[model samples]
Target: MGEWVKSSCNSPVPHNAFVAGRDVDGSRIYVGRAAFQGDVLPAKVIPNNRVAYVSHNGSEHRVQYYDVLVGQEYEWVVCGDGLVPANAISPGTTSTLERLYVGRVRHNNSLTIGKVQPSRGCILIPYCHREHSFNSYEVLVKKQRPKLWKSQSY
Candidate 1:
């Protein structure tokens, strides 16, 4: 397994850290548009494929857990918690993610980070019987409730 770190000016360094099943080298960042303009984007160090679906709007990006359909954009706010985009879509839309740790909440209209359980997922990485078909594998499908954003939870 491997580890990576995310350091941001708005928040503390090493805010979101995780162990990756594959080699996780943070030597370079695959940065893309922050989905917003003039917004000080948070330094992100998510796994190769995990992220919170974000919808970009007029000079802003709404980063949320809810799926962001193409051609649409929402708000431009972030929970103080770290983010993990959906790595894969299970049969029931239960997203399989990687390096999604820590919970976030809104306190007095301010983002707050909370307790988090280290998590990782991939169809190729078997947490169960290794002989199952990649698409039909149920190991990652069997996860606890994944509430995108709890009002005051983790």
Candidate 2:
């Protein structure tokens, strides 16, 4: 039998990790299958319980952790493909973030990525010609790609 934790339970993880799986260990992760296939950024796995799949819904990368008992849900931070794990979350309690993404929209803009400080409520980007720090919604909007150009075109 496996122990269970719920998002609604309103508690931080008692241990750096509160659970385990058959494939990964010592790393943070979700306990089930992903709804959509999102990018699996670099992260430390708990030996065998790492999150191998994700479903990014075009907004923020949202991931859900479910209690095996009542099937309750716990959300985790959807860290981006930056140096930090996309699962990093704010420093309040052990929360699995519901919705949030920090990466460049390569639609027509240049390649970019969102940087994050897990304990701080902020994001950073290197392309804006600014130091990596807290990013705002305005920053995200302005960062969107208005056009795409080839290397030879430059």
Candidate 3:
């Protein structure tokens, strides 16, 4: 249930923030950040109603929201111990990468979705006071969708 807000050059991007994606009209959407290319980048929040399990620093945790980047032409795949580009998974697992989102567990039963920094091996879920880290977190993955087919009128 996230709302789309217009962003301008002067718009303040919170620290560790990343670009989500562009709207239909071509405006970029910024939710937060996630790990990408051995670095952190802006990512979009994918709403989920079901619980999913994740391994954080060798410990298992449950989460409901997925912070990810949507690929334009390529999808991400889970390969062995980590995620790999779709093409790189030819001899690896075909299961598309999912359940890679990160969030902080709040006492109020709410979550603060944030970014992932794989180089540091942690998920940075921001709080009003500061950013918290959960070491042994995984980077978010991007999934590409097939292009829509257009029908011609006879």
Candidate 4:
């Protein structure tokens, strides 16, 4: 588990991770993808309140657990039970869209990063992977890397 560091607006976010923000209802919103009637829709806000990441054996990626505050960034380590199906999203029509939620699923017996999919309900996952049914994966909002200052020797 990586140590929690107070993150500022300029803090660096790891690769393949989403930049979480609060909605009007004060819930954490993750903009990802959703499966609808055999089609994967993009830019859809995940109907959940938490975000997650998979920390590899030698990974330094830290999981953000709460709203960013000065001198106090919340974070923790998470592990999967290996019970949830990788391709857990069920196809739904427009009428069933309200019941759709985002969940993470990882490939069995692999240490790769998990993929986000539209689930019947929100499945909070610490890590996950892929399945054959899913083709393209959702790419959410990412925090920009801080620019480094270059010293010029004239």
Candidate 5:
């Protein structure tokens, strides 16, 4: 019963907001459950209503607004239990390597607890760690874990 909109058109929908529908050219598109505060498409669009759910952070929402929101598969991966840089820490000036995934993120510029996956790997990390693409630093972390020392520079 919800209303749907198009992604390309200028609509009243929020910036991070998305619409489930075909482009004016008949091409299909997809958007993730979690949206940022912008007017750009988050992911590629797919044809057909095969997608049924959109999960952001930890909460899952039903893509029932076929007329307003476009349906897309949620494929975002979460990162967990890894040492991050001193600046990456949300707060505290401890020289020690602190846990980056502290179950919170800056939502609307405010502190809020994040909903994480259920798996041991990415389950403990916040949505911020999960990315459609991994950064160079993150890639290095996976490749040189054992050989690299705790404080070694990549």
Candidate 6:
């Protein structure tokens, strides 16, 4: 884990998913892509290789999860970048539509969904996972949700 520091803006630098003096202990959580493998609850989940059945635009599809890279102290975002383009599909329809996604990072043609600091407009690097298998894996973009986001304070 990295040590927290004071930003030039004077705001406490966020460390290990917690913004100094802004986040509560044990408040950060992650959620899975679907209500399976005990991910029914609204919390963070370890991305394991499981048959994740998701629904998008009233359509159902099966998505495979690979080994997810987790535990990054901080993340940076490519401004104006969003969900990576889906390649050619084997059985399902593969449309190369550029959708507006809030919490995905892109490097070249590959894109991975991970935790995002909505307040800071940044993404968590370690949590990013690559899952685009044109002939094997198909993720429902519309049904996908950001596993990490800033909690709305009441």
Count of backbone clashes, every candidate in sequence:
4, 27, 3, 6, 9, 4
Native-to-model Cα distance after best TM-score fit, residue 52 in candidate 5, in Å: 5.2
lDDT of 2 by residue, 17-92 (tens): 3221222222333232222343322111122222222222213332333231112222323333233333323211
Question: Which regions of candidate 2 are displaced past 4 Å?
Answer: 1-108, 132-154
Full ranking by TM-score: 3, 4, 6, 5, 2, 1
Which window of 10 residues has the lowest lDDT sum in candidate 5? 133-142
Question: How do the predictions measure up, each by TM-score?
Answer: 0.17, 0.19, 0.31, 0.21, 0.20, 0.21
Q: If both were scored by lDDT, which would come out higher, candidate 4 or candidate 6?
A: 4
lDDT of 4: 0.29
* Candidate 1 vs 4: which has more TM-score: 4
TM-score of structure candidate 6: 0.21
lDDT of 3: 0.34
**Model 2 whole-model lDDT (C-alpha atoms):** 0.29
Q: 3 or 4, which is superior by TM-score?
A: 3
Ten-residue region with minimum lDDT total, candidate 4: 67-76
Candidate 3 lDDT over residue span 52-72, tens digit each: 223333233333332322233
lDDT tens digits by residue: candidate 1, 1-154:
1122332223322323321112134322211112223332222222242432121121212332221111111112222212332331111111333222222232233232221213212122211112111221111111235579758766
Measured with C-alpha atoms, the lDDT of residue 72 in candidate 5 is: 30
- Best model number under lDDT: 3
lDDT of each: 0.23, 0.29, 0.34, 0.29, 0.27, 0.26
